[model samples]
Target: MLCENCGKNEAAIHLTQIQNNEMTTRHLCEVCAEGMGLSSGSSASAPLADFIAQMGKGMLAETVSQPGTCPACGLSLADFKKTGRLGCPRCWSVFDASLRGLLRKLHGGTQHSGKVYLPPHPSESDRTARIVSLRRSLTRAVESEDFERAAGLRDQIRRLEAGQEA
Candidate 1:
């Protein structure tokens, strides 16, 4: 599908935003999405901020200000929309509802799916350190969407478990 914003590049990012019982949808290309700071490298808060902004464009604009603002930092949904950055960590709690939906959309599931690695080393400390290293590798694999490497990591973890049982 063509990008809603540019109408030139193919839309790769499909966003459905809901706020105050209102829903708004936008399909954007990588470039357009990046322009709005909605690209992959952007911070976790960007999509939620953008989604809130899109939803606010309709009837909820005025009503959202008071309740939507972070009590600690005084960062409103409007401020998030403008900056694409949350005022502080407290903003996460303040806007938890909105961010949850955005997160579900971005990731297939809200729960962490990345595998944890354990090693079969004799020394407990060595095993712990190896597990930490392997977990870091697994995290990078999942983040990069490298299914092959992730599968390998899973298999390695399984082998470690089998060795432990023996």
Candidate 2:
């Protein structure tokens, strides 16, 4: 297939954009795709993972200046964009907004739809880990002033505690 934009080279990129119940498809060569901003820089020819990370960077660039730092590691949003890695466990909450946007852009959806691997019989350790994780999330929610999320986490924690007692 020929490039839809330039009509010169063979199409190497197929992009499907859906907006408001309308779908638009474009087939473009590397050159045209890069020219149209559908691709990244000179490294646009890189693998899909790199391309997706580039897209995430572009999406996060605008929000990097937001004031928030990981309470545990002191990682700022700008630092995450540069390294593409969180400095500490608490960084997730600190950079939640930017990370969600980046995740949605990179994965096309933020929700996890993949199969979860669980042991046939969950051990006591698993329950303990779950409770610990929930407590951390609850703490982060409260610190971030997300009362609604904190409430939900509280309810979940209560349920888990009740289950343990029972």
Candidate 3:
């Protein structure tokens, strides 16, 4: 495909933009796409550089400066930053606001409304056996005083329970 803008260079990028309820699709080569302020790399063009700078500024503005606190254990975002671990499930709820900003930075935005396909239907007995194994692992972790491992097992058990319920 040829670039829509250059009409000479072979297109290597497809960009779609929605404006005023109308969708516009453009096919462009890397150079043309960069010229239109779409590439992530630094551009020599003043307009493209300015647009990228503004986007960076906007992202910086949206970042969470204040630390979040876990409601259950009173653990703070600073705690997670230091240890890279969460206290409990309740930490998710408490840290959600701040985590959303971090997630957006890492993943582009807080939109995970995507599809996930599962097996047609696993046997109930199979799920039950898995839950039992997870419970045993959790018990062992607790007995060994490995709280982190126990927490992971607990979360797995909870997910299994939820899947079974569904």
- Predicted model with the maximum lDDT: 2
Per-structure clash totals for the candidates:
0, 0, 0
TM-scores of the candidates are 0.33, 0.35, 0.29
Clashes of 3: 0
- The local distance difference test score of each candidate is 0.71, 0.76, 0.72
**Which residue ranges in model 2 land beyond 4 Å of their true spot?**
1-53, 61-65, 115-166
Q: Write the per-residue lDDT of candidate 3 for residues 18-54, one digit (tens) a residue.
A: 9999999988998888887788333334554354444
Every candidate's CA RMSD? 16.0, 21.2, 19.9
Model 3's TM-score against the true structure:
0.29
lDDT of 3 at 109: 86
Ten residues in sequence with the least summed lDDT for candidate 2: 40-49
Which residue pairs clash in candidate 3?
Answer: none
Tens digits of per-residue lDDT for model 1, 18-75: 9999999999998998898786444445566676556434423333333657889899
lDDT of 2 by residue, 5-107 (tens): 8898999999999999999999889888878777644444346545544665686555755557787888876566555667778777777777778888767
Against the true structure, candidate 2 reaches a TM-score of 0.35
